[model samples]
Target: MNHASAFDMDAFRPHDHGRCRRAARAAAERECQARGLRLTPARAFVLDALLESHRAMTAYELLDRLREAGLGKQPPIVYRALDFLVANGFAHRVERLGAFVGCVHGADDHRAAFLVCRSCRQVAEAVLEAPPAALTAQAEATGFAVERVTVEAEGLCERCRADA
Candidate 1:
């Protein structure tokens, strides 16, 4: 994450989740239109499911949702949707949890850092301006091209901490 900037993640605080979900959908529509990408019903549904909360959800969980919605019963249905979403920067995969979350920020490609709650499994997303200096240095030394990075810090969220 960008250490120089101040950021408040709504996931860590109370906010109008309805408004956030609607805005994310609208942004996805606009982005798809601009990019000439097809936002299929299944894709939209998967995105909506991910945006419904800050918690990371596994593919099987998402597939269950799809099945309940009568979208698809097969695994490939959700997997393809996830593939498109991750490819277009509309969603992020939480490696630690082996799950996924919708991107809060718009479709613009940006580095993301996450604060993951160990107790509740909620994830707060933050933008990183660039790769960390130490990591970049190590990669350069090894002649490794760093294509992507997933930074996740695990701990308790405020609500969970207070409850404890």
Candidate 2:
């Protein structure tokens, strides 16, 4: 149940890692195609790396993978690819971790909450039926424009909690 390990799409457990990875890639390709966009090699590589693991990864960590793959050795290259992935809704930045994770469930722009395991730093994405009441009321009172909302709840997952 390591978050750094493969992710099981349906059960949220480890299973068919490669299949899930390919599905995510294919989904990204389809999304790009429908939008008249291209999933460039670098972007695809970064996304694939993220898809390979549920744990959030920093830019430098990804850059190392890119280097090993001969994609690019420069930090800017990785950053640019991340920018594209995040901007295009193929990925999301875990602000708390300052890292990135691939969007396997669907497009990134959707309103989804993030469950972050404090012990393992593994992130699980969850779709919220609606924005939290407090947040909505605060926004309304301030007349703040809300573009996208992602809630980050920190706690131990079942595996981690049990290990404790």
Query: Per-model C-alpha lDDT, please?
Result: 0.86, 0.77
RMSD of 2: 5.2
Cα lDDT tens digits for candidate 2, 38-135: 78899889998998878889999999999999988999999999999888878888877888888776664555567777777778876566677777
**All candidates: CA RMSD (Å):** 1.7, 5.2
Q: Choose the strongest candidate by TM-score.
A: 1
lDDT of 2: 0.77
Candidate 1 per-residue lDDT, tens place, 91-115, comes to 9898989999988787667667888
TM-score per model over all chains: 0.92, 0.83
Cand. 1 TM to true fold:
0.92
